[model samples]
Target: MTDPGLQPERTHLAWRRTALTFTVVAILAARHAADHPAALVLIAVAWLAFCGTAYTRGRTTTRPLPHLTPVVTVCSVLALAVAAVLVR
Candidate 1:
């Protein structure tokens, strides 16, 4: 008989990796925005940290796995960071 025990863990790891990727892009955006006021850059960094934390926490939830909220959040934050950098 086949088993289906490791799938959830794999899913969690995938999403966690996605979150980390967004966080990295956000960090780069923050660095690129260094010439502007510190507040924007700090906000970007903080948002990235929050995204990573949320994904890490989501990995522990039972059933249904994690929702798309974390992914959406990461995308939104990444977009905002880029926007902030470009607006300068």
Candidate 2:
């Protein structure tokens, strides 16, 4: 029998780290936008969505994950939120 590779495990861990980073950034953004309720909600929602997608992908995927759609969506939303806060 051959040894199973650790790539999948590493990939999952990488996604987990990305989710964590997103969460931290969201919190910081919330602090900076404390006067803006809508921006804070949007940041929190985007972070939660990313976490859900990451969890689903980790559970269902077998091969090296290569999807970027979720990441892009989260980033775009966050960028919008940042821009809104900046303009405030």
Top TM-score hit:
2
Candidate 1 regions off by >4 Å? 1-4, 38-46, 49-57, 61-82, 85-88
| Global Cα lDDT for candidate 2 | 0.69
1-88 per-residue lDDT for model 2 (tens digits) = 3226876677678778877887887777777777877776677777777787777666545643466645756574766567466638
Model 1, range 24-46, lDDT digits (tens) per residue? Answer: 76667667676665645555655
For every model in order, what is the number of clashing pairs? 0, 0
The TM-score obtained by model 1 is 0.55
Which runs of model 2 end up more than 4 angstroms from their true locations? Answer: 1-3, 63-68, 71-83
TM-score of each: 0.55, 0.70
